[model samples]
Target: MEFSQLIYRKQRRWNLFAIAAIVSLLLFSSLYLMVGEVFISPFSEVTPLMEQLVLQLRLPRLLTAIAIGASLAVSGAVLQVLLGNVLAEPGVLGISGGASVMMVLVLFFIPVFATPVGFMLAAVVGALLFTLLLVSFAQVARLTTTRLLLVGVALGILSGAVVTWAFYFSDDLSLRQLMYWLMGSVGGASWYHHILTLMLLPVLIWLCFKGQVLDKLMMGETHAKQLGIDVEAVRWKLILAVSVLVGGAVALGGVIGFVGLVVPHLLRLSLGSENRYLLPMSALSGAALLVFADIIARTSLDSAELPLGVVTTSIGAPIFIWMLVKNHDSR
Candidate 1:
C-alpha cells in the first residue's frame, strides 16, 4: 500500500510538471511571435504587415527553433544514456562539429551547393560519416566511455582545424557567411525548409517512444542483454537516430550550442533519471528554451540581432559550471 501511494504521488507530480511544461512552451511560442522589434499584441487587430510578419517571418523561425531545440535535447538525453556519461552531447561528441565542417567545406569549395537544402544534405552526410567513424573506433579500440569521449573531442578538434583552414582560404563574402553560421542564427529561415522541418516530426515521435529501451540500457549492456534487449542492435539504431537529429539541427540552425547539453541536465535535475519522463519533458522544455533564447536574440539589441548561439552559450555555460560543481560536491 505504501509503495502504491508513493507511485501515485510521483505520477501526480509528473503529470503536473507535464502540464506546466506545455503551458511554458505555449507561452514562449506566443512571445516568440509577438515580442520582437515592434511588439505586437496578441489580441490586437491584425494588419497586413502583422500577417506577413507572423506568417512569413516569425512562424518559420519559431518552428525551426522548436524543432532544433527538441532534437538536440532528446539527442542529448539518449546520448547520456548510451555513452553512460552525463556530459555527452552532439557538440561534445563531435557530431555537430563534423556537420559544420562538411557544410563549411562545401560552401568554400563548391559554390554551386550554397543553398540551404544543399547545406543541410551536406551536414547530414558529414554527421552520418562521423557517427560511423566513432562507432568504428569504439569497436576496434575497445574503448571505455571516457576514452570514447576523448576520441570524440579529438575528432572535434580535427574538424575545427579543417574549418579554420577553410576560413583562411575563403573569400570575404564567404568568410562573413561562415562566421554567421559558426555563431549561429535563424534569421534566414524560409518556407522552403518547412518540409524538412516537418519530416522531423516522425523521427521525434519515434525517439520519444524509445524511452523504455533507453531505460533498459541504463542498467548497463550486460544487464540489458540479460533483460532480453539486443544491446548492439539498439545502440546502432540509437546512433542513427541521434545522427539524424543532430545533423538536422545543425543544418537548420548552424551549430547552436548547449541546447543538447543544458536542456537534458536541467530536466534530469528536476525530474530524476527516468528516461520515460526525461525524454518527453526534455523535448517540451528544449523547445521552450530555444524559443525563449531566439526571442532574446531578436530583441536584445536595438538595431542588430545577436547570434542565436551566443545567447544559448551565454545562458548554458553558467548552468554547466554549476552542474559540474554540484556533481563534485555530491561526490
Candidate 2:
C-alpha cells in the first residue's frame, strides 16, 4: 500500500473504533437502566419505583463507572509515556496501593474520616507521599525503568501488608466494610459521588491533554530538555495529575485494577503511539469496558451480584497474559 493510503486506512480504522465504542456505551446504559429488581419495559410501564431505581440507583453507578474508567485509563496512558515503560500503570506504580492503605486505615481507625471527601483527601495524600518516596528512591539508586518497576512492586507489597494489618485490628463491622470496598462495587454510588467525579474528570482530562509534551520527552529526557521543555516540572505536574485522578477514583470506587493497564495498551496497539488519539480513545474504551463489566457483575447471576473488581480481573488477567506473551514473541 502507498504511504498515503496506509495513513487513510489507519484513520478509518480509528473512526470505526470510535463508533463501536459509542454503540457499546449506549447499549450498556440501556441494559443498566432496564435490568434490575423490577424489569421496567421502556414502552409498556414506567412506575415511580422503576424511575427511582433507574435514576437514583443505576445512573450514579453508571456515571461512576465512566469516571473511574476514564480516570484510570488516562493515568495509565500518561504514566506509561512519562516513564517510557509499556508496563507502567497506577496499580503497578504503588499509587493505588498507597491509596488503598490509607483508605483501609481510615475505615479502621478514624470513624469521623469515613466520608467520601475525607477518604479522597487521605488517598490523594498517601498516593502523593508514596510517589515522592518512589522518585527519591529512584534518584538515589540511579534507577533504570526495570529497577523502578521492581521498586514499585516492592512498595506495593509493603502497602498490602499495612492494609492487612489494619484490617486484622479493626472491628468486625469495619472489617466487613473494608472488605466490600476493596472488592470494588458501584452499588453504593450516589449523586454526591457522581458530582465529585464529574468535577474532577474534566480537569484531569485537560491536564493529560496538555501534557502531550511527554510524547517528545518519551524519546529521552535529554532530548526533551534540549527542546526547552522543563523535564522536572512536567514530571511533577504529571505525578500530581495521576494522584488526583487515581486517588479520587479509588476513594469513590475502591481499587479497580487492570482497566488502566489494559485500556492504554490496547489503544497503543490499535491506534499507534500518538498520545492525542491514545488518551481520548483510551478514555472512551475504558468507560465502555467498565460499564459493560458492571452490567455483567450485576446481572450475570441470579440475585447475587459479583464484585466489579472480580469481573475486571477475570477478563483482564487473560488479556494481560496474552499481551505479555505477544511482547515476548516480538523480541
Candidate 3:
C-alpha cells in the first residue's frame, strides 16, 4: 500500500510538471509576440501597421523558434537513447555541424542553389549522410560510447575547419552575411520558412510518440532484442527522423547550438529519466527556452541584434560545464 501511494504521488508530480511546462511555453510565446522592439498590445485599438508587424514579422520568427526548439530537443532526447549516451545531442553528434558545412558550401560555391528551399534540402542531405556514418560506427564498428563521442567531436572539428576556410576566403559582403548567419539568428524568418517548419513537425511528433521504443532501447541492445524490439531497424528509422529534424533546425536557425544539449538534460534532472514523459516535456521546455532566448537576442541592444547562438551558448555553456563536472564527480 505504501509503495502504491508513493508511485501515485510521483505520477501526480510528473503530471503537474508537464502541465507547468506547457503553460510556460504558451506564456513565453505570448510574451515573445508582444514584447519586441515595438510593443504591440493585443488588447489595444487596432493599427494596420501593428497588425502587419505582428503577423508578418514576429509570428513567423516565433513559429520558427518553437519548431526548431522542439525539433532539436526531441532529436537530442532520441539520440541520447540511440547512442546509449546521456550526453548525445544533434550538435554534439556533428549532425548540425554537417548541415552547416553543407549550407556554407552551397551559399559560397553554388550560388544558384542559395534559395531557402535549396539550403534546407542541402542541410537535410548533409545531416542524413553524417547520421548514417555515425550509425555505422555504432552498429557496424561497434564502438563504445566514449569512442563514438570522440569520433563525433572530430567530425565537428573537421566541419568547423571547413567553415573557417570559407569564412577566410569570402569577399567582404559575403563574409559579413555568413558571419551573422553562422553566429545564428532567426530574424530572417518569413512565411516561406513555414514550409521547413511543416517538414519538421511530423518528424518531431513521431519521435515524441516513440517513447516506449526509446524506453526499451535504453536498456541496451540485448535487453531490447529480448523484448522483441528490432534494434537495428528502429535505429535506422530514428536516424532518418533525427536527420530531418536537425537539418531543418539548422536551416531555420543557422547553427544554433546547445539547445538540443541543454533542454533535455535539465528536464532529465527534474523530471526523472522516463522517455515517455521526457520527450514531450523536453519539446515544451526547449520551445520556451529558445523563445525566451530570442527575446533577449533582439531586445538586449538598442540598434544591433545579438546572435541567437551567442545568447544560447552563453546560457547553455555554463550548465553544460557543470553537467560535465557532475558526471565526472559521480563516477
Best by lDDT: 3
**What lDDT tens digits, residue by residue, belong to model 1 across residues 259-311?**
88898887777767778888998999899999999999999899999999899
The 10 consecutive residues of candidate 3 with the worst lDDT sum are 174-183
Give the alpha carbon lDDT tens digit for every residue of 187-228 in model 3. Answer: 989999898888888888888889999999988889999999
Off by over 4 Å in 1: 133-150, 172-175, 328-331
lDDT of 2 by residue, 1-331 (tens): 6999988988787789889888988888788778876777889677788888888998888889988888888888887776666877777777788988887777667969888888888888788787777767666777776678788888888987888777777678857676777767788899987656965677567855764686777778888888889989988988888788888888878778788889999888877886766777888888898998998898888878889988988988788778768766877
Q: Point out the higher-scoring one by TM-score: 2 or 3.
A: 3
Q: Give the top-scoring candidate (TM-score).
A: 3
CA RMSD (A), model 3: 1.8
User: After aligning candidate 3 to the native by TM-score, how far in Å is the CA of 119 from where it should be?
Assistant: 1.6
TM-score of every candidate relative to the true structure: 0.92, 0.91, 0.94
lDDT of 3: 0.86
Pairs in steric clash, model 2: none
Shift of residue 75 alpha carbon in model 1, Å: 0.5
Measured over all alpha carbons after superposition, the RMSD of each candidate to the real structure, in angstroms, is 2.1, 2.3, 1.8
User: Model 3: how far is 172 from its true place, Å?
Assistant: 6.6
Residue 322 shift from truth in candidate 1, angstroms:
2.5
lDDT of 2: 0.80
